[model samples]
Target chain A: MATTAGERESSLWVILLTFAVAMLFSVVSLPEFIPWQLGYLRPQWVELVLIYWIMALPHRVGIFSAWVLGLFVDVLTGSLLGQHGVAFIIVAYIASSLYQRLRMFAVWQQSLIIFVTIGISQLVNFWVENFVGLSQWDMRFLLSALVSAMLWPWVFLVLRHLRRLFNVS
Target chain B: MIGLTLLSIALMVVDHLSDLLDEVRSGLTVVVTPVYIVADYPNRAADLAQQMFTSRDGLQEQVISLEEQLLLMKVKTEKMSALTAENNRLRDLLGSAAKLQDNVLVAELVGVDPDPNKHEVVIDKGTQHDVFVGQPVLDAEGLMGQVIEVSPLTSRVLLISDQSHSVPVQVVRSNLRLIAQGTGVTRQLDLMHVQGTADIKQGDLLVSSGLGNRFPVGYPVGIVTQFKHNPSEPFAKATANPSAMLDRSRYVLLVFTEASLREPVIGAEG
Candidate 1:
């Protein structure tokens, strides 16, 4: 599965494009595009994208890049400046370290792992937000993690299709 | 990973403790505003298409209704000027200055904060239009919120319904002063520190008291929607629905009040 020099070069652009679209999806108010109630169940599109890239191409996208992108999300959402950054760095570290095993799992098993990773990320966000007195504790905060896990297979398939189409490493 | 974690914590601490990062955040907002505009494109396009496809007869009917409404408002305003002049004369007799008229700029909401836990919105007005942090915002119905961050072409408003936001308000009937805190619910605000025997009741009107000098006095804040009292508890809990349409308003007014203009500069130490 070794990638040639040309494939490696092209993958960078594809990665950036995918990440950009994911970021757009993460910040856009889906409620306006869809039904209002469904906004509460909107999946963590950026985290799903990050997880896919880290699993598919661990060497190219790692912890540091994830942290930077998380900062972008924080600024975009008007949350605490570093709230997403910390959670994302942890998720990226775990995903990259386990990338070899993660790629070999069945889609359902992979989705199970996504449930754990995104749950951890959401928990970290809840902790930081509550610590700063920005948000209250609620059972509903965990809803997004579950929703992200449910969407994992579709996101994985689409990202995989894009990677193969672009011959991305 | 450890370095990044520590750096992020440091940023959180700095952002929470001081206004130092506000400028940096505002500068970054310039870069992100394009994304918001693009994200908002679909709604704007839909609105434009609706307008274009509207029937001419429907437009004419709307114009006639608007004209009649304008004439009625003009007549009311004529009476209001006489009342205002008399009020000013009475205030002068009491050795007080005349009430300052506020300058206002209309801005449209361009985007909403996607985080359901937080309440904030981006307005189209910014520093280019003299918008600044701490400016009070209002919808046509009532007081809404204040500007927290300003970029070149846009600004972020911290809605009064945000969990961290609070405003000083007085009951219109009893003149009882209480602080209204956001419950992170778009439709309601919680009144803090009210006694079980307080005069608050359902249907009471709450208006800004101007105690902190941040919000102007006598503007409608909310109306008491629910009241709960427990004799054993030291304080009674009450909730009010905000007068402004926090969830649906498309346009807001940025009020340029004298107090905000005269606010003291934050020292470097802060």
Candidate 2:
């Protein structure tokens, strides 16, 4: 039984590591990595992970984690200080707020809502950057939102498998 | 918490007082570099493996041709160094560090800001590598913007073509200095505060004048694409395409120095 607990703990670490790696991958926007316009079609991998953890183990992923991740992103991306923090917090809040409703929705419906949430998050990112005086205002900004929406189903399935593996009852 | 906010505010004040923020940003950037490298490793390896497995004869031919081009460039660079030494000698007589060009660290762009209005990009190098804010960022061709923030291993560069960004530039052919501001269009720069009678024209090259002591002097900034002047209006409506390879850059150089700390006063127009 103690071994089983240890295994479970290790698995949890694995999950967190996977999430961090995924975030890093999503963050590194090499030109021509995606077939679309350069750096335009980045999927909101951070938002996907946020939604997954919120849906699977709502207790572990919370407002503070979301805020900190946002800060990391802000620091990494070099935007205004709190811009990603503001967006991530709002996205997590909305995801958690709609958690029960989201679980009941079909995969596509859930994905749509996720799309809108990530879209709004991107918009807020745009807003804060512009307000802090870094506005670009190009249509390519919509690319990430679209890509994130499309990837939602795959992310959902992956989270479901991880949940079962962990036996998150 | 409000306490955290107050603390951050205090840190901001202290940072301004003692320039401690650069140290903190540099430390954070160092820490993040490993994370970015670890994440990039697997994909990069897979790419290398794939390249080894399937490179073709045509590609090899192209590589040989590219090598020839590179050899030509090396010869040109040798000549450039001789001219640069002569130019430095002249500049020394004029009194100043010859406006040493910013020593730029070439960094792979990792990400773009997740918004349309915010034209920012994340580069792999950060403050740990000695990158500083106010340092100009550039793509292959021209000015992109400045280093706005830095993490331990990464830094963000604000592109000059973003709506909220602006830089001091001079018309190369006519020497008409003006502040070129971004309009969020990502395609053009709006030259601000120029009079209708200002000696400006289409196809003029804009270069950094190094007046603010922020960006190094003489980097190609943009080119005049269009001009609109109304007979009654005080200023001419002019736009220039930013010289930076804004839409196509995958790597950027962060220039981290100026010739002086004090702003250079405008010399009388020759």
Candidate 3:
């Protein structure tokens, strides 16, 4: 089980690549002029990616990295600074605590957890936005969670493959 | 975990309740800009591909039509010079403010606010380009918005159609002062505190009144599309279509007011 330095370095790079792709997707909306009702379809890409990494490597990608990632997201999205940081910290805390059970569950059941975790994260966003008087309808929170849950299986498979390919463990 | 979460909450509260995080946010914006620039490549590429694939005949037709439109606009503006001189003379008689032509810089819309709750766009121009906060932005049609945040390489614009945004406007026909509030819809604006007996009609024009001095005077704001009077409500209801294409325009002009122009030595930066 002698892992070379190159492999270890590559594992970090792979994780970064996933996060970068997620950030890119998080900021982009297809067609750019979508109506308000259709906005929930824009899945929380950064949160999804963070969930996968924390689940896969609970020791390596823990609360600190999640907070840093969330800070970047806050800047990228132009929200109140550290708003996403709060959400990501909470999600990371929950995901690491439940990582074993999450790994043991079926894909469908894993989505249920994702639904709750992402919903919790979106709740933080919703609450912060409301506090700042940038309120949207309540439907947006639930619909965004549903959409993120629906995308969980695909996101898990892809990240797992990348982890396996790069030996991220 | 608790410590970090507390830090996050503290950061949010401080950022929201005070200007303590403005400098921090601006510094971070410089770092995050590269990701947005990379993400925006697809849109720029799509535009280029469309231009590359367009038929030569189609481009020729477009150029011809644009030239004709330019000619028509030139004819319309030909009388503006005389009118401006007359207006200036009348203003001089009244001891009003001088209407010096504003220097404007062109900027391209680079990225949009990721949140659906806000109507904001990031433009390519920034403090590097002398794009300061509260600077007025415009398209060829009319006033679009004002700059709210300025970083070194980019600035954020709060569009006139945001629910939180409002512009002081006056009716063109009756010269009655009113306030136009954004309805969170790009095509509509609500005239607040309108009296039931107000003279606003379906086609009346609205212009910036320059009362707050955010937007310059006489720029078209919107054209009234609907008005209603209800005895139950305290104020009459009226809505107008925004003159600028809030959701459509890709390029906008950033205006440098006379007050801001006095700071930097004119020949120093240029």
Best by DockQ: 3
Ranking by TM-score: 3, 1, 2
lDDT against the true structure, each candidate: 0.85, 0.72, 0.85
Q: Which ten residues in a row have the lowest lDDT in candidate 3 chain B?
A: B261-270
With a 3 Å backbone cut-off (N, CA, C), the pairs that clash in candidate 1 are none
Q: Write the per-residue lDDT of candidate 1 for residues B210-266, one digit (tens) a residue.
A: 888788787899999988988888889899999998878889988877666543332
TM-score of 2: 0.75
For model 2, residues A101-149, the per-residue Cα lDDT tens digits are: 8889998998889878988988987765554444446566777888888
| Native contacts conserved, per model | 0.63, 0.20, 0.63
Scored against the true structure, residue B60 in model 2 reaches a CA lDDT of: 88
Of 1 and 2, the candidate ranking higher by DockQ: 1
Residue lDDT tens for model 2, B153-192: 6777888887767899999988889999987667789999
Candidate 2's C-alpha runs over 4 A off are: A1-5, A30-43, A94-98, A112-127, A136-151, A166-169, B1-35, B38-111, B138-140, B185-187, B249-270
Model 1 chain B weakest lDDT span, ten residues long? B261-270
- The sequence of per-residue lDDT tens digits that candidate 3 reaches over residues A17-117 is 89999999877644645575465578888889998988889878999999999998988877888899999998899899999999999999989999999
What are the runs in model 3 whose C-alpha is more than 4 Å off? A2-6, A32-36, B262-270
